[model samples]
Target: MTVHPSVTDLMRRAEDAELARRAHHDALTGLPTRLLLTQTLERVLARRVTHAPIALLLIDLDNFKQVNEFLGHDTGDAVLLQAAQRLVAATRAQDTVARLGGDEFLVLCENTNAAGAGMVAERILHALQHPADGHGAEARVTGSIGIATAAQHHGPTDLLREASAAMRLSKSRGGNQTTLFDLRLGGEAGRLLDIETALREGLERDELVLHYQPIHTLADGSLKGVEALVRWNRPEHGLVPPDDFIPIAEDTGLIVPLGEWVLNEALRQLSTWKRAGVVPANFTISVNLSPVQLLQAGLVDLIDGTIAEHGLTHEDLVLEMTETALILDRSTMMDTVSALAETGASLAIDDFGTGYSSLSYLRYLPAKQLKVDRSFVAGLTTDPRDAALVAAVVRLAHEFGMTCVAEGVETPEQLEHLRLLGCDLAQGYFLGRPATAEVLTRSWAPAGVN
Candidate 1:
């Protein structure tokens, strides 16, 4: 049968309409695309005549990349689709759910204020807790939701930017949480950006310096090792605490280069100390490793080469990391720790008792030492429970053929307690604070001389 020209034109127009609809929606989730979402938001903001309350919720899937990297992109796509469905179910029919692309979804809620947005956000967060692909247990995917009310911003750009900032704050605090955009987050975000920019410049300008804190044998007071801590010596800021900038570096992927600098500089310092005969022959330098460094493909080679470059052996270095870092990525933790251990560099669980599931994770790691966190050590002399806990950890370390280290040994009494508990090493201000090589050589050497 021959089709009429009018019928052909109508069919062509219908196909064009379908194409436009598809372009404005996501293929997998069938939710509105960012283009449509933005258009809708613009319209809502532009219509000042009908003052309607509006809010935006931005959802970021935590560790979603891991799903794609480990389980395959197909599994990742399934998780994304599931998350989109949960976002829809958690909101009102008047709300619009849009895919902001790649594990990020946006919800535009009409007639919702901050408090109302909060309830919706909590619902969406809870809904996103399930495994994305039916095998949720293996993936452990969850969403971080950030809510921003239209009352907070005058335009779509500001609303989305604030929502994104809040989402990042939630993610930075550890995901599976909800955040509402606030002025505090705005200032904090700006401050972090400033710090990040300064830190990058500081690193390049050789303003990054290492200060070594001596860890001494509790019994003999002989130096056992030193932990290398990085500090940014900005011209105007003096010495910026690692706490202030280290997290920024870790989140911004600057930790990789910062970590490399720590490794090389710490090793170089240790070699110099060894040649000076100040440190014992078995003295090892410890450096903290961020989770990002563990995932680096060249981590093992980097460690080996840095050690050799400083004329040091693998045994002369100690790699310290938090258990939570290892627990979050089990497969990588095993491979990375095993590879580092094989390099003859010892591994230590830093801030040992902070994690709730510490004992459980210890079984899987080949760590040679455990550093009791400052919190526990701070209470060692006063709190009987803290003392008992430290004693148990020390004994456990001995049983496992590992040395137990007590960090933040502030007082002589605390040192005594750690010594009596059979702790192998102690580090604190009472013994020696973190110092430059010049001061450490002058201060620490005199103690060993006598």
Candidate 2:
């Protein structure tokens, strides 16, 4: 059993070769995997001369998951194999096609410029669009392609990243398309990444602050409540507006924690105001809830616990949700909202007339207030249609035994019009701009306030 060194070396080398082959190739499609693709790309890049460009195309199959779910995994595998075969047929013999797994493929185009790369992408998309015969039938699939050329001195990782970013842009533009990576696209992607990172850090480091916008009664101009708007006091970029970061938060699921922070912070401020006797015992604070927050489990418990901790009653808090929130998972959303309403907290449909302008939710859901969208209110004084719409909304809210608030009432004429229409509340720059707690307390607090 004590073999010579040469014999042992030969056996070890054979085993190593087998392992390398397995690692570099996909089992199902028998195409090169990401490892081999990278290696081959590196080789081509190292030998590349000026004006002799190489392009990388990243292909993502659109709605491939639906096919897998409807057909089966076996059928999905067959489709993938057929896709790989078609990709090979579409490219030159010298070009490389690799399977990146899970409905993604990578193609390396040798001596190809942007025009040639685009042609290749088009061919690939056409090939994938046709039905792939499997299980005695054909399955339809589409490809979204991203193309990046080695016109710039980019490494393997950067090239792949650029191509991937282009692919995402293609998918965003409704898929089944090709996008070429440019500086603008890269800049936008980089900006989004920076914002995402900064937002996560901002949450952890308390860089976000709440600014209160006073909501006053249309009849008396008395401060009935205030809406807590979140602002990011980013150190690098001073005072990033909510519109800039909130959508990113929603997309990244950061909104759940961000929403929780907003609730707790608003309650804490309300508690402070109550303790100082700056606001009445019945003073209400409104906080906007993202659709994602409503779908999150334990939202009720979090809200209940926070209110209880602040020694505030449910009536002292208003939860404002957009109309779009209602249409996402109606049954579960209704149940959750019902539980919230049972807690005695008022539920409001914010931007009410803008989305899903159906009267059914007002009749069915536990909504207590309807805030007419600013778009309809913005033209109330000039546009007869806008005025009629606002009046109709106010009337509808009252018919359902709910309060109606008119948003963006910027002018005296608009205020008078809303008052005539029986709007219960109004919020706009003319009433009060969003301000810090100190500024709002100084202005709106009782005359003897600190």
Candidate 3:
């Protein structure tokens, strides 16, 4: 204690301290690391026995990887920094902002409950809605927040787990949202993690399958074609609904491979039906094209090769493009649609009146059919405005000499209304939910109806 410290020793000590600090904090945002988060959570839980309430807000940036891939890592880093600043600004001085690694940020709010946590989440979302600085471009960011409140009776890990689960529900509902924990659903977030793992291995294990729903002519009730829908027959998860996994696939960019698998499998099934003479030679099998699939570089070529591999004519296969996807990039999307048409495959705009159903985009796309959305069909009988909308859609399709397909005809009244409006085709739960190829082969015998 009496001796003076050496300069070299002081420098070495300073370097070691800096390294330790870096280990406990995020490099880019200088926020607390996951290690720090855990320690804070433990301390807060210990204090919950005496002090007021506390909550954790788990935030995940939606589609941040897409930004990283499309832009560069540098731009992505800039976005993360901006997000960190906003998070700090949104929370009070007492709260802690931590980076739990890539695109995941957390806030530990002391003296807060579920209601208080919800208010904080709203503020954070509103703040993130502002533009983020990244080089010269403005990066638009959105977050999904999951709130976990600390109670005297709750375990620290359990509270964090529930909050993470709620975050997943928010992301599932589409990002840029928030959700609170519920006892029911038994931690869907945990279930989703398991499902994602299974989905990755599903293809190699052949757990994924396709089911087809028939589309019939409203006037004559003759089978026109079938729309191929994908299903996951998991070993333990039983039957996972498309609504559950499809959004996950899209967000995770697994839709590319899943889409390809669906196309190949659907085509293979169609081929078998043809060989067995169960389906008519002129019948078509419609496949929904995901936006990511459409954006792929070799989409047209891949489709052409699949058709060639299946030994199927282009007319025997139809591609159903969602109107929302068509509105994304007009010129390039139109070009791809035109290229598909060149291969002799027909195109139908699914959910035609929904989304941003731009007529200008329609004029450019080489679509031969328009599938009216279910919402317009739901009240077509009782609602005159709905009937008029359907009538106008039919007339518009007719003007272009394209067929009009009315979806969601549950009641006889709805079917009759569609027929009166001169709709060409009808498909809905009333017709049938999607069925396995074997079931369709045995049950759907297209006899003398045509």
**Best of the candidates, TM-score:** 1
What count of clashes does model 1 give? 1
Q: What range of 10 consecutive residues in model 1 has the weakest lDDT sum?
A: 130-139
Worst 10 residues of 3 by lDDT: 324-333
Clashes of each: 1, 0, 0
**Candidates 2 and 3: which is better by TM-score?**
2
lDDT of all predictions: 0.80, 0.82, 0.79
Question: Can you write out model 2's per-residue Cα lDDT over 139-159, one digit (the tens) per residue?
Answer: 889998988888657767667
Q: Give the Å error, residue 311, model 1.
A: 0.9
Candidate 1 residue runs with Cα over 4 Å from true position = 1-142, 145-166, 170-186, 445-450
Clashes of 2: 0
Q: What does the lDDT read for residue 398 in candidate 3?
A: 96
**Tens digits of per-residue lDDT for model 1 on 1-450?**
996679889999999988677558766778887768888999888874455788999888898766655665445566776787888998889899997655678899888888998898888878877655635535668888888778634677667766776787889888989888777655766676567778778889999999988889877877788889898898888998899888667645578889999998898888887888877788888899987677565689999998889898988988999865765445545777998888788999999977666776666678999989999999987899998899999999998889999999889899888888889998989988899878888875844422
Give per-residue lDDT, candidate 3, residue 410.
Answer: 86
Q: After superposition, how far is residue 316 of candidate 3 from its true place, in Å?
A: 0.9
TM-score, candidate 2, is: 0.64
Badly placed stretches (over 4 Å) of model 3 are 1-189, 444-449
Ranking by TM-score: 1, 2, 3
C-alpha displacement of 388 in model 1, angstroms? 1.1
